[model samples]
Target chain A: MKNHVQWESSLFELIRRTSVDLPCDIEQGLRRACKTEKKSSRARWILEALLENVQKARDNDAPLCQDTGSLIFYFQVPVGFDTNALASATRLAVARATRLGYLRQNTIDSVSGSACATNVAYGAPTFYFEQCARGTVDVRLLMKGGGCENVGKQYSLPAESLGAGRDLEGVRRCVLDAVVSAQGNGCAPGILGVCIGGDRATGYECSKSQFLRKLDDKSPVKILARLEDRLLKESKVLEIGPMGLGGNTALLGLKIGSMSRVPASFFVTVSYMCWAFRRRGAVLTVRGGFKKWLY
Target chain B: MALLKPRRLEYPFTPEQVGSLRAGQFVLVSGLVYTARDRIHKYFFDGGKSPVDLKNAALYHCGPVVIRKDSDWVVRAAGPTTSIREEPYLPRIIKDHGVRVIIGKGSMGKVTEGACKAGGCVYLHAVGGAAQVLAEKVVSVKGLYFGEEFGLAEAMWVLELKDFPAIVAIDSKGHNLLRRVKSASLRMGRKLMKSSDPFIP
Candidate 1:
């Protein structure tokens, strides 16, 4: 609360960790996928390359992917906390992280196509702040690359092409369609974060938020949790494998969340995440000091 | 039904060598590779000239993490980006620059395959997010172009590589490995969706 410089430093550390290190669950998913493929197979080779890259990035303290992706932050704090201060601190941390090579200069002008060297332009680092009763601060970050973002798809229900209706069957079909179309383009052995029953904009936002969850963490809703597992198991049948060369492991995880929607709209939003899957969180103490890292 | 051994490639390679390579083959590429992404491709599509010659060279679709160290630019993470996004501009770039091999993640479309076949160029699929591993293969950052104008990610970075890993996803013979994978998956996907198994909500 008193030392502004220290707070910024703590945020910088969070940003750096999120960029350079691959979380254990994701790394384990890759390792497990590597074992499933045949010896010396293309899928195995690709998995090995990814695992090897993960280690090298951590050991060298380098950004895992050159993209360093879009910096999306979720801040949950107590009602009385100063939100504006935290936002400014985060923006400073992002720019410093870029300069120190933890993050690449990735933001660009939509009008001119020029790069934002500092990655601090308006709407560059997206922040979502909400008040929580926990009386603490939790900042979560997801570095989603452009490649996978380009592959994210949204489907409207009652589609003749898929025979998808306004039900779970429809959601499943839409997800399968998304993965099938993405193939290896979105980077297979990927993860799918889905949102059902939300409006067009909120649908994608909710789906992306699912990436903040651990690979093994099921949704609180029992049906959604079961769907998550079923979707993952079915993805292997697609046989897209890692980077789409074809293998046993098609997807690592699938998470689905839902929001209340108007009767007229039944949108299924699918947010595709590449195997890189860089997501990290930090819990701050009551006095605005770093408490612990939340994977 | 692919070979275990990785075929070694040196950049500025010939048409015959590129033609001989088939889809689904693993390759360890070495030598001069040029990095370019959406902006550079758009530049070329708009008839902008390349400062460095791209004829018969390895064109990597990457926006690498490079920084200055004692006056020399160093590549920290130089993994491939998704290639499909560049499809609109690739055919023209291949025609204009005579680009020998295209390196990136994911599969491209019909026109890219046709252009590769006609131009005798091949598409190489590098591990999508293996930037640090790929950067390790980059022995040196030789030169840069359009750094100021296009920004770091969009600029053309000339890299000297050694034993960089990739696979031949689209060969010069009009064969596309990624496309084949997608089509087969599509059949399975159709069957799965049509199955009787239902998720009881």
Candidate 2:
């Protein structure tokens, strides 16, 4: 077995490095969007400024943007592993990473109005654990910034509005409304992860889980598969183009996931992701070695 | 050729000049503008309070930003916050105060638009997240209005600015570049989607 201290140190190091730099996909997307949007002077200017900010952040080792975001950790643990020890070690790792990351202490007293710069709150480093038969642990770190998080919305559309069988059109309307309503607050040319057919809580959870999927991953389920195809087509139609400037691309991608819902309800939820979708992941072995997985 | 040179503007700007201004048109404004945000807006609107003479003045949608000495405030970083948050109360505030320009990021909704058209005012969008860059434009930090009890960051600050850069995001003519851009993009999107195999081919 590998030493827990070594594992914790490695995790902290990975978190610190990823926080200050723009992820490769985000960088590529922005560059490509900028090139395609040259005619749009406003879009080009804002995008160039954003790109400049990214470079400055990376060079200076600053948090990529002012809103460093809340930390979300996803853990995939091996079956038969000692979960208790892992949890404690993970907490220590997070606390150490928070200190070294020089991240803005965002946690504050919501009611009492006190500030906690350490980024550790009552339920911070929000953990979602999944047990698998594999003999290794996989961890994913996602810093969901507030600007994008605020635009997330969940709705239960009437079954009749979609269609007699399944109102796919209603789903389309809700998604369009959500993006249009968001305007530029969530930062335009954003990504959206949508969940269809789950109960209220699962609907929201699945919406977020879809963000974890690879940008290129194809949907596995049929309804979500169709919805994804249609929503992507219609989102650009809303004209909330890049950076909320008029452009050819309003959204980078539309990802969808679905779950069983009650016969009477058609629940659809959306989680918006800003241009800087800061996330990283790693796979950990029992031998104390790990490989960075998500970027 | 350069598109247009930046111009410095002041209060009592003519209707003709305001009409020429379009959302997304950049301008350098020099004048006295008040800094107010959520807390001050609520206090003024709800608390039955009036602090400044509102006629022909500008109300910035900002919670700028200061550090302290023994008895005074010094601005550290003052920039525009997102403007859409104040859409609920902006029209009333503009009418009540006879305010002219509402400066912030993003676009305000229909209510503010109607108020701007009716009240002969405009909405300006400062670049979001450009706090440090925008701070260079402020010539002086004038004084505070209220909410000092709240904190340095959240208080109502009265700022004296010169050559403050901004874009008219929503104008007196009801021309909103944000809305225009969205409409144009949506129309193009429908056409593109209607065509078969429209995936960047």
* Among all candidates shown, the one with the greatest DockQ: 1
Quick one: best lDDT, which candidate? 1
- For candidate 2, give the lDDT: 0.68
lDDT value, residue B53 of candidate 2 = 82
CA displacement after TM-score superposition, residue A294 of candidate 1 (Å): 0.9
Q: For model 2, name the residue pairs that clash.
A: A105-A117, A162-A167, A163-A167, A237-B186, B23-B168
Off by over 4 Å in 2: A1-18, A38-40, A80-102, A108-117, A157-170, A220-230, A284-290, B1-20, B28-37, B44-81, B91-101, B114-121, B127-166, B180-201
Just chain B of model 1: what TM-score?
A: 0.97
**CA displacement after TM-score superposition, residue B171 of candidate 2 (Å):** 2.1
- The TM-score measured for candidate 1 stands at 0.97
DockQ, in order, for the candidates?
0.78, 0.21
Under the 3 Å rule for N, CA and C atoms, how many clashes does model 1 have?
A: 0
* Candidate that would win on TM-score: 1
